[model samples]
Target: MEYSKDDLIEAKRQIDSTLHKLKETVKTLESKENVSRLKSQITLAKRRIKAFEIANYFLENEIKKDK
Candidate 1:
């Protein structure tokens, strides 16, 4: 499906917001004294952040093309 520039822009904004939150979560999780149990959570968050980063990169390229 084709999305308008505005829609793509909004989606990019949401992704950026999510990316920020995920990074913060990883930071918070890593700072814990005992992170044995949180290891999985931190790993999952890191993976998610990576995925979102890829999405953000595509969105940025698309936005630039839309210009």
Candidate 2:
């Protein structure tokens, strides 16, 4: 299924929030497993956010080009 603009915006927001929480969790995690998991999730979130930002930028540019 395709995502609407609102959906993308919400997903991006959620990813940002999750990333922030993961960072904090990393700092608080005394266990190696917990730290590792948080780090992995944070990495994934960063990748997702990067992709979204790139897409958003491309879309914005395409809109401008159309005018």
Which candidate comes out best when scored by lDDT?
Answer: 1
Kindly list the per-residue Cα lDDT of model 1 for residues 1-67, writing each as its tens digit. 8899999999999999999999999999999989998999999999999999999899899989989
lDDT (Cα, tens digit) per residue for candidate 2, span 1-67: 6556666566656655665665565455534555665776656655665665666566555545545
Report clash pairs, candidate 1: none
- RMSD, model 1, all Cα superposed? 0.8
Show the lowest summed lDDT stretch of 10 residues, model 1: 54-63
Q: What is the Å distance of residue 56 in model 2 from its true position?
A: 0.7
CA deviation > 4 Å runs, candidate 2: 1-35
Estimate the lDDT of model 2. Answer: 0.59
Model 1: lDDT equals 0.94
State the lDDT at 18 in candidate 2: 63
Q: What TM-score should be assigned to candidate 1?
A: 0.94
